[model samples]
Target: MHYNHYGREPVQLGVGLLNEPCASAAELGQRCAAAGLVLSRAPTTADLASVTEFLARWRAVVECVERTGRAALLNDLLAEYASAPRLTDHAGDGWHLHFRDPGVATDRQIAALVTVGTALHLTGLGMDRLGVCAADGCTRVYADTSRNGRQRFCSPACANRSAVRRHRAGRAAR
Candidate 1:
């Protein structure tokens, strides 16, 4: 099951944002750039605030356990943040779909990008692909881009820790 960059990268960005929040617009801009997002300009304080609020909403979609509820939340986000999809050659990178209007504010652009990307991810993969880490005391979120789609922990370290804990508990019980 191959997933496009649109379906994968933005969800990763959302997870990154939720786990390690940005302290300033500059940091947010830097993070986006690091994630391969091209911003027209540096993010401002207002952009930072708006992105933070949007991430809070995006987190709900991630935390939703029911498939229907997750879809509904993502639909709400798509309606609120995204525009009609259109193909564009923006940046001369090649023709591709844009879920937002061109020349929007930086924050609005980020909102639209992340929202639409998440929608594509869930629909293309599975509704259960997004989740919080199952490791004890680890609250990180993850988008399961694995081929088998059975990811439960946010990382291999967390998975190992969880397995060790379970093994220890079983031994103790025995």
Candidate 2:
């Protein structure tokens, strides 16, 4: 039985979706394939637009977590994405669990994976592990899997930029 490493991969995929929304359904299929997920459907170009819009809503879940409301926001996302639990090992690997049913739509599948993965990550780590980038102009979402859990920026470059901006502001205040 392969234990799904459901924490980081889904979050990274979510980030990728947010960072570069698919311009066409084929692009969406390609992107998910690159992310190591096999799409059950061949999405049409219109589906790509829907996926982008759905991802925008998913980003809202990140945006709602402002040091507080983390639990509430995550709960909301989980509720939105997760379905009634069911047992499935139809691939004949081993008897494991599936939150949603098989043959679900592409967008729903992505959302379920992302929401459950995000919930698991935040709960397993800490409620404060997810947030927006601390960089001045970057609204990117960051899931802080750091040991210290004090991570703020989406990337080191953003962190450095934010630090420099803070230093400059301090100097100017003097």
What TM-score would every model get versus the actual structure? 0.94, 0.84
Clashing pairs in 1: none
Q: For candidate 2, write residues 1-174 as lDDT tens digits.
A: 466635577877787788666667777777777666645677776667666776787787777756456667667767877888788766666776666668987777777877888877877888777778878789787888899999999999998888899899999999
Which structure among the candidates has the greatest TM-score?
A: 1
Give the worst 10-residue stretch by lDDT in candidate 2.
65-74
Q: lDDT for every model?
A: 0.88, 0.75
Local lDDT at 27 for model 2: 78
Clashing pairs counted in every model: 0, 0
What are the C-alpha RMSDs, in order, of all predicted structures?
2.2, 2.4
Estimate, for each residue in 1-174, the C-alpha lDDT of model 1 and write its tens digit. Answer: 322436677788889999999999999999988878877779999999999999999999999999998989989989988998888776776777778888889998888878988988888898898999999899999999999999999999999999999999999999
Give the Å error, residue 17, model 2: 1.2
